[model samples]
Each structure stands twice: as C-alpha cells, then as structure tokens.
Target: MQSSSSYPEAVEQLIAGFRRLPGVGARTAERLALAVLRWTPEELHDFGLLLATLPERVGECRVCGNLAEDDLCPVCRDPARDQSIICVVENADQVPVIERSGGHRGLYHVLGGRIVPLDGIGPEDLRIGELRARLDSGEVRELVLATGSDIEGEATATYLARELRRPGLAITRIATGIPVGADLAFADSATLATALNSRRPVG
Candidate 1:
C-alpha cells in the first residue's frame, strides 16, 4: 500500500506497524494511524509510553499461568476462592466469563493455549506441567476442563483428562451443545451456567 501524500515516511511506518495486528488491513491501519495523529501530543506520547512498557510490566501468574501484574493473579491469591476445585481454561480472557456465570467459585489454571498440532502447539508447550504439580499436591479435589468445544479444544481436554486422572482427584469436562467452535469468553451467562451445571465426568 502506497502512503498518501499528506502522510510522511514516519507516519507510514506507524501505519504499517498497526497493519501487523490481527484482522487489521491496510485501510484500517491508515485509519488508526490518522486517529493517533489527531490526538494531542501529550496523549500520543503517553499512549506510546504505555505500549512500550506493557511487555515488562505484565507477566503470567507463577501458579495459574494467567496474565498477572504481580507474582500471582488475583484469583490465585484470593483466600475466598476455593482452591480444592480448579477450572482449566485455554486462556486468561475466559476467566471473567466463568466468574460471571456465578456457577464456579474455584480457582483457575490458564493453559496459555490448546494443543493444536496444525499450529505446532503441543501439550509440552502449554502449562500442563504446572497443572500436574498442582494436582500432585493433593489439595485439589476436582478439575473442571473449561476448554472450548472446538476440535483443538476437545483434543486438549482429552489429553488433560488422561494425564490428570488420579485416585483422589475427580476430572470433568464442561457440557457441550452450547456454542460449538466458539470460545467460552463469548458464551452468554445463561449458556455458560447451564454448561457448568451439566459438566460430565471425564476419564
């Protein structure tokens, strides 16, 4: 995409950077760049600084692998949360959806991503080791697999169920037929609540 006459080389570079974002095409990138160019110098500078510092300022929780500003995320550190029951999710973003359903009071373990062989993601690449360590501690009584109902999500859940089965621990997968191929984060509260209530034991 050629730059407009009004846009300088530096502005074009910024637009190209924005274009690298997911679902952003050249036209959308130009729009975003123009919007930023319209901002006050102070606002633009602050926004740039925030973006620059994000990588260093945020990290995964040591225990649950969720995005965290500190050593552990709020859910992992909260005393009110039930530690005996753990909800295993594909990513941190899905956490709020389960919380909103008001059906789960347990802590969470973010797998970072599912096992998608086509994408070259494997079980070892995720946080499955940490989950096993948590279960080995014998404190957890139940594991609710909240991965999506898509092909990759199903594969991930099946792998986890086989890997995490133990004498004292009960493993279950969330009920499907809610929104196949969609993420748990996008499911409505009622659907998510029903799925949670109808979770089935997974061997």
Candidate 2:
C-alpha cells in the first residue's frame, strides 16, 4: 500500500518527533516542525546538542528528588531557605508550581507520586522512606503536605500524616484554594499561593 502523506520524508519525521511529546497533537506537531525548519543550521545544531546532553546534565536531586544538574537540587544548596519546614509534594513538577506561587519559603520533598490502591501503588512505591530519613535528622519541625486534591493524593497525604507523627513535628495540609480532584501540576500560581498560605494542621 502507498503512504498517505505528501510532505517530504524529513518533514514527516520531524512532525512525528514533535508528536511524541506530551499534548502535542498533529496540528501542533506540524507547527513545531515548520518552526524548526525556519531555524538556522547553527541554531538547529545548538538545539540538537542541548537535547543530546540533557540526559547527562539532569538527574534527580539526592535530597529532595527534584531534577538537578549536580548531586543536590538548587533548593537543597540554598542555605538561606528555612530548614525547619519541608513542603511535601506529589511530584517534581509540583515543586515548580509551588515555587512560582512564592509561598512556602521552606524546602521540599517530591514523593514521585501518590498512593493509589486500584493502580497498585502504595506508600512503599514512593519516596516515603527517603522522607522518613530526612525527618529522622531532627531538623524539620513542620511538614506541609501539598499533594493534589484528588483521591489518590488525599490517601497519600493521610498516610503520611498518620505514619510520620512524632514529637515536635507539626504536620499541616494545604487549605481550601485548590479544588477537589485538581492536579497541582495544572494549578495556577495564585491558587497555590493561597493554599500554601492557608494551610491547616492535619489531624
């Protein structure tokens, strides 16, 4: 059978590449390919080099599980940040969302994902062990649970709140701003800020 596309093989290949990325549909992929085609050879070379080196340059933060170029993430290296409080989030993506809000000056811990029983993911599948190790160091006084408002997120938060209870630790949950069933990855900075600022003690 003959192929359906009329475009050159290279252009089709570029569009396919863009389509592999999350949320890039056929139209968007075409637009991206066209845009890339307009770039100078030197610009294209630079872009290719960046993509080639991305894997070597980026790795998970040793302390917080956020993406990092070195052994620790930028937040872990900053001594000025509040060391006594740690905001726990569901994923590294949510770290930036909360950061953009300019709320919660404390450091963060990325759980990697929430607990979903139906999906067969439990607390053991996440970074809960690493979190426990951090808490054991005796520096953190408060833990701000910033997981999503969804069911799985709620289960994970509740699990952590129950498991991590101990002397002098004040565990708090983000308050009313984020709507139920909403993912922190898609939440606006303003809403995140409100949620963080209004955090209440978790029972």
Candidate 3:
C-alpha cells in the first residue's frame, strides 16, 4: 500500500516544500500542508503573493550585510542608536536575539557566516572588509563579538580580534552562558543578556 497515493501530487509537493524549512520534519510538514489546504482561497493567495514578493522586497544592507528593504538596515538608519559600539554577529537572525535581550544599545555588523576551514569558508569570504571600513572611520569605539560558541565562531572571532586591533578600539567577546557548540540564535533572552553583560576583552 503506497501511503502517499492517497494525497494528490500537489499536496505531496506542498508537504515537501514545508519539509525543506529548517527544523520542520516530515510529519510536521504533512500537518502544515493539511492546515494550508484548510485555509480560504484568499488567504492562500495572499500567502503565495507574500512568498513570491519576498526575494524582491528583501535585500541585504550594503553597510552591514543585514537584511533590509533599502540601502541600510533599521539599526544603521536609527539616529538614537549608539554608533560608538558595534555588535558583530554571524547571521542576520542573531541580531534580533540580542536585541530582545535589551542588553545592547549599539549598532550591528552581520558577518553573513563564520569561518569554517573544512567547508572552505574564510575571513575573506565574509563581510570583514566592510566592518574594517566602518571601524576605520574612527566613530566606533568598541566591538562586541556575539558569534556562536562553536569552533568556526571561535576561529572567526580570533581572526577578527587580531585584524581589528586598533589603538582606540576595544574588542570583547560575549562571556560564558551560551554553551559551547551552541548558536546565538537559540540562546534565551536572559542568557544572552548575561553573556553581553559579562563580555570580556578578546586577546
């Protein structure tokens, strides 16, 4: 008995698409497909339009490499944000994680990714040049490394510390609380706050 034969090809395709999303398993994908099937045609149409327009509407911020609708992200555009400090994160999503903690009041620089040697990703592959340019402007006084505690994150932080050491600039890494091998995206608000509050200088 072929279990998938009961559903139409389109329904199976929808389930497959849902499965492609991060952390979504086959059972959850099937449930999501069923839920979508139950939605009104208008709602489904609106969702389709949202998905279709996403790529065109969303663009990377030229300054910090974060997601934005225009040239600069909201953080970069905000006048009240502390321009003297910059929090460096591995991904755009981690920005919100730190923001919700309410421990940081500065600007952000998304690295796009960490340095992974085995995967052939290096510092040059990231947005390091852009970050350096921002620092060279003499406006930034401090940098907080909020990358994950994984090996790649560690290597990226170490490389950045060495390359970004300047006379007036202070470099620090988020202290322990976020366990080793864990991504900042998964850390809770309180834990993230503690890490930020206890950040120590990077050697």
TM-score on alpha carbons, each prediction? 0.84, 0.93, 0.92
Q: Write the per-residue lDDT of candidate 2 for residues 1-203, one digit (tens) a residue.
A: 02318778988998889889989988888889999999999999999999999999999999999999999999999999999999998778777778889998999998988898898988899999999999999999999998877777788889999999999999999986675443667788888898899999995
Q: Indicate the worst ten consecutive residues by lDDT in candidate 3.
A: 176-185
Candidates' C-alpha lDDT: 0.89, 0.88, 0.89
lDDT of 3 by residue, 1-203 (tens): 14455898899999889989999988888889999999999999999999999999999998888889999999889999999999999889888888999999999999988898899998899999999999989999999998878777788899999999999999999986775433667789998898899999996
* Candidate 1: pairs in clash: none
- After superposition, the stretches of candidate 1 with alpha carbons farther than 4 Å from their true spots are 2-5, 23-27, 117-121, 178-182
Q: Kindly report which residue pairs in candidate 2 clash with one another.
A: none
**Model 1: per-residue Cα lDDT over 129-163, one tens digit each:** 99999998989999999998988889889999998
User: How many backbone collisions does model 3 have?
Assistant: 0
